[model samples]
Target chain A: MLRNISVEINGKRILDNVSFEPNRGINVILGPNGSGKTTLLRVIIGMVKKTEGKVSLKGKISYVPAEFFSAQMKVSDVMLAGSRIELNEYTKVMKKMEIQGLINRDFSTLSSGEKRLVLIVKSLVEGDVVLMDEPLGNLDLANRAKVLRILKEYDKTFIITSHEIEVLDFASKVLLLKNGKVLYSGNPADVNESLLSELYNVKLRRGKDGWSNFRFDF
Target chain B: MKGINLIFLSLLIISFFLSLVYGQVYVPFDKIFSLHGVYKTVILDIKFPTTLSTLLIGICLSISGAIMQLLLRNPLMDPYISGTASGGAFGAVLAYYLLAFNLPFSWIIYISPVIAFMFSLIATGLTVLIGRKTGVYGIIVGGVVISYIFSSLITVMITEMSIRFPQVPPLIFWLLGSIQIVGYTDVVILSLLALGLVLVSLRYSRKIDLVSISDEMAYSKRIDPNKFRVFWIALVSVIVGYVVSQVGIIGFIGIIVPHILRRFYGGNTKSLILGSITLGSTILLFSNLIADGSLGFEIPITAITSLIASPIIIYVLVRRNAQEY
Candidate 1:
C-alpha cells in the first residue's frame, strides 16, 4: 500500500503524489517510456527510497527487474540464494517455468530470455506480493503467452509494469500511469481507448480482439 | 568433493609435520610426540606455536579472501584489497614509535595490535564509502589509493625509527612479512579469530551467493545487501588486521589461495569457504617451512609467495578477460 508516495533521485522527482493498492490478482501498470513505471516498482520493493510519504507493505516481497543482471555463478545457486526456502520448492517453480534444465549451467552463459525466466522462477518462490518490472519485455510470443498463463494461474498478488498492452485482458485491474501520476485505476474493462490515447498522447483504437492499436494522433 | 577434501587434509597434515623439522634444530619425526628435554621444549614451546600460528593465519586470511570475492563479486578480490594490510601495519608501526619515543614501556607494545585492528576497520569503512558511489572497480581503485597513502606513511616512519636504533633490523624486516612466535597469546588469538570467521562465513554463504547477483534481488528476498556487504567486508578486515598485527603482512596467501580453490574445486559457497581453509592451511604451512628452512639463515615468506603468486594473479585476470569476450 502506497500513500502519497513520492521519490526524488539526485534532485528530479521520479514518482510524485502516487497512492495505490494493488489488486490481489494481476495488476498491470500501463504507461509509455519514462513514465516512472520501473521507479514505482522499485519503490514498492524498498529498493528505491521514497523521499516523502509512507508505504505500508505486508508479507514478503520479491522482485524481478526488467534488466536481469548476470553474475558469474551457476543457475542452481542463483535460485537458492538468500533464503532458507527448500530446494524442492524452487525446483518445482523452475520446472514449471521450463528453466529446470538450465540449473547446472552458468548464469552468465544463459540467453537474455532464459535469464528473465530464471529470475521469474526465483521471484515466484520468494514473494507473496511479487513485483515484476517489464518481465515480458524481450520474450518471444510463445514465452510471453506461457508467462501470462502462469500469472493468470497463480492465486497470489502481482504488480507488473509493462508497455505491452496486448495482455491487458489477463490483468484484473489496470493503473494507467503517465508523467509520474496515476491517470486511472480500476477494473481492466473500465480502461477504454480514450484513456489510453490520452495516457500515451497518441490515437489508440480498440480492436475486435480486445487489443488496442496505437497510431500517431498528430 | 569428498576426494578433494581428503587430499587437502593429507597435504595439510604432511606440511604441518614437515614444517616442524626445519626450524632451528631438526627434530626428527619419530621424536615429535616423545617429549623429554630440549627436544621437548623446542618442539612444544617454539616449533608448535609457530606452526600453529602459520596454520591459523592461513585459514583466516584465505577464508577472508574468499568472502571478499563473494561479497564484491570480483574474482580478483583479496584480503589486502580493502587496505587492511597496509593500514594495520601503519598503525602497528605508529604504536612502535609511540613506545620507543614516549612510553618505552614493555606492555605498550601489546597495545600495537589493538590500534592496528582499529585502523583496519577505518580503512575498510573508507573503501566501502567510495565503493558505494563507484561499484566493484571503484572499490579496488579506492583501496589501492588508500593502501599507497598508508604505505608511504609507514616508510617515512620506518626511516626515522631506523636512524635512532642503529643496531636494530632494517625496517624492511617488518614490511617484508615474517612469522615469529610471540607466545601462547598469538596462538590463542589466531585460533579464535580463525574459528569465528569460518563459522560466520559458512552461515552466510547462501545469502552471499544471492547478494553477489544483485542488491535488488537480495533486498526483495528479505536480505539487506548493503548490510551484508559491510558485515562481510568488516569481517575480512578484522581477520586481516589480526594476522598483520601478529605476522606483519603475508601477502598473496589471501589472493592466491582462493583462486586456486575456485579453479580446482569451484565457487559453490560450501566448497569456497571450506576449500580455502584446508588448502590455505596447507599452502601457508609449506611457505613457512621454506621460510625457516635448514638453510643457514631465515628468508621472508613474502619473498617466496610474491614470486609464485604474481604469475597466478595475471593468469586469472587474463583468463577472466578471455571468458568475457
Candidate 2:
C-alpha cells in the first residue's frame, strides 16, 4: 500500500504523488516509455527508494525485470540463486513454463525470450506479491500465450507493467499512468477512449486486427 | 567432479615431495624420512618451511580471488587486479625505507608487516568506493588505475633507496610478485586465517550465487547486496592484506585459478571455493617446483607463475572471445 509516493531524481519527477491499493489479481500499470511505469514497480520493491511518501509493504515482493541477463550460471542455479525453493514445486513451475528442458543449460547462453521466461518462472514462485516489469516484451506468440495462461491460472497477486494494450484483456485492474501521474486507476473494462487518448497523446478507436478488434488509433 | 579433487591432492602431494628434496643438492628420496644426516639438515631446516609456506600462500590467494569475483560481481576482481596487493606492497616498502632500512634489515621486519596490513585495508576501502560507482566493468578499470598509481610510488621509493644503500634490488621481487617469505610466522598465521575464512565463505555460497545474478534478485530474497558485499569485502581485505605482507603480491592466481576450475567444475560459489583451494595450492606448488627445479640457480616463484599464467590467460581470451568477464 502507498500514499502519495513521490520519487524525484536530480530534480526530475519520475513518479509524482502516485497513490494506489493493489488488489489480489492481475493489476496492470499501463503507460508508454519514460512514463515511470518501471520506476513505480521498482519503488514498490524498494529497488528505487522514494523521496517522499509513506509506503509500507504488507507481503514479500519479488521481481522479474524486463531485462534478462546474468553472470555465468546454469538455469537451475539461476532460479535457486537467491534462496532454496522447494525443488518439487519449482520443477513443476519450470515444466509449466516449458523451460524444464533448459534446466542445466547456461543462463548466458539463452536467447532473450528464453531468458525472460526463466526470470518470470523464478519470480512467479518466489514471493507473496510478485512485481513484473514488461514480462512479455521478448516472448513470441506461443510464449506470450503461455504467459497469459499462467497469469490467468495463478492464484497469487501480480502487479505488472506493459505498453501492450492487448494485455488489458487479462488485466482485471488497470492503472493508466502518464507524465508520472496516475490518469486512471480502476477496472480495465471501464477504461475510456478519451482517457487513453489524453494519456498517450493520440486518438484511440476500435480497429480490427485479424479475427479480433482492439482499441487501435494509429 | 570427485576426480578433480583427487588429481589436485595427488599433484599437491607430489609437489610437496619434490619441493622437499629438489634444492641446492638433491637429497635422495629415501633420505627424506631419516632425520639424521645432511638430508635431514636440508629437508627439515629449509625445504620444509618454504614448501609449506608456498602451499598456504596458494590457498589464501586463490580463495581471496574467488571471493573477490563474487563480491565485485565481476570475474576480473583479484588482489592484484584491484591493487590491494600493490597497496600493501607499497606500505611494506615504505615502512622498510622509513623504519628499518638504516638499521640491520631484521630490525624493520616487525614494523613492515603491520604497516602493510594497514595499507592493504585502506586499498580495499578505496576499491569498494570506486567499484560502487563504476559497476562491474569500470571497477576493474578503477582498480588497475589505482594500482598503477601505487606501483609508481613504490618504484620511485625503490629507485631512491637504491641510490642510498645500493642493495634494494631484492625489493623488486615484491613489486613483480613472489611467494618468497622472510619468516615462518607469517605463513603459519596466514594459513590459520585462510582456513577459517574459507569455511566462513562456504557458508555464504547460496547468498553469493543470488548476489552475483543481480542485486534485485538478492533484494527479493531478503539479502541486502550491499551488506553482503561489505562483509565479504572486509574478509578479502584481511585475507589479502595478511598474504601480501607475508609473501609479497602474487598476482593472477586469484583470477586465473578459479576461472579455469569453474570450467571443469560448476560456477557455484561452494564449488569455486573448494576447487580454488585444491587447484590453487597445487598450481603454486607446481610453479614453485619449476622455479626450484633449475639446479643451483633458484628463480622467484612470481616470475614462474606469470610465465605460466600469462599464456593461459591469452589462450582463454582468444578462445572464448573475451566473454568470461
TM-score to native of every candidate shown: 0.91, 0.91
Candidate 1: regions farther than 4 A off: A67-69, A190-218, B23-25, B166-170, B294-297, B323-325
Residue B253, model 1: lDDT of 82
Candidate 1 local distance difference test against the native? 0.80
Residue B34 local lDDT, model 1? 85
Over A23-134, each residue of candidate 1 has an lDDT whose tens digit, in order, gives: 8889999898998888888777678889887877778888888764466667787888787888889889888878789887878678889989988998888888988989
Cα lDDT tens digits, model 2, B9-97, are 89888888887777555777888888776767677666777778888778888888887887677777788888888888888788767
lDDT of each: 0.80, 0.77
Each prediction's DockQ against the real complex: 0.59, 0.56
Query: Residue B4 CA error for candidate 2 (Å)?
Result: 2.8
Clashing pairs in 1: none
Model 2 pairs whose backbones collide:
none
- What docking grade applies to model 2? medium
Show the lowest summed lDDT stretch of 10 residues, model 1 chain B: B165-174
Q: Interface RMSD, all models, one decimal each?
A: 1.9, 1.8
